[model samples]
Target: MIQLNTKRQFVYFIAVVLVIILGLASRKYSNFLPTFLAENAGDTLWAMMVYFGFRLLFVGKRILTAVSLSFLFSFGIEFSQLYQADWINQLRATILGALILGKGFLLVDLIRYTVGIVLAAFLDKLSLKYNN
Candidate 1:
């Protein structure tokens, strides 16, 4: 595999923080958004945040590594919703838990995740290109 350049951890950290803010704003201000955006923006931003989080954590890794890990994690959380065991459900009931684990599974969320990860990777590449 081709070696990709390392990313600036601080930049990725800022990206993650900004994405989290946007995700919260998307939910808080959903009424002002168009129907589709209101419904999908939060999830999209959530996935983007996940991608940035991975990038931040794996600073020396290729962008594909971050993208793949983000997808695996995001999809894993979504799929975990299908298992309704009491222990996990209880955990999901809490605010932080719900934010991370989610309450239920929706197929559409997978597509939203894909879009988010792809967009984040694209943006990261552009930033890298300009930085170099």
Candidate 2:
């Protein structure tokens, strides 16, 4: 049976919150950042947030599992953009939906999500190795 590590889950939850704050800040004050970085950072951070969220929920799972699930979820949301119903688009127009669902599909966003998940997984593994 898998054990629940409350400490680790709490840490992951905190990290997710931090990432969300950073992501929102990046979007709000993007003018401060270079155009290239600002354009991609929010999406990348969103992927990281997803990764940490999965980590928080599945505390004892392997990092690969969490990362894979994050990627699948992120990619699913991105591809879902292909469907543009009036109701769905209206939802996407809101702050929460805009943040989660995004405005449109971009192939580059997939690459950003992949990079974010891989980097998060690598860092997660490193943290686990060193903490132990």
Task: Choose the strongest candidate by lDDT.
Answer: 1
Best by TM-score: 2
How well does candidate 1 score on lDDT at residue 9?
80
Local accuracy by lDDT, each model? 0.92, 0.90
**Candidate 1: which pairs clash?**
none
For model 2, how does the per-residue alpha-carbon lDDT over 25-128 read when each residue is reduced to its tens digit? 99999999999889988999999999999998888898988988998999999999999999999999999999889989999999999988887888888889
Query: Model 1, residue 88: displacement in angstroms?
Result: 1.0
Off by over 4 Å in 1: 1-7
Residue-by-residue lDDT tens digits, candidate 1, 40-70: 9988999999999998889889999999999
Query: Which portions of model 2 miss their true places by more than 4 Å?
Result: 1-5
Per-prediction TM-score to the true structure, in the order listed: 0.93, 0.94
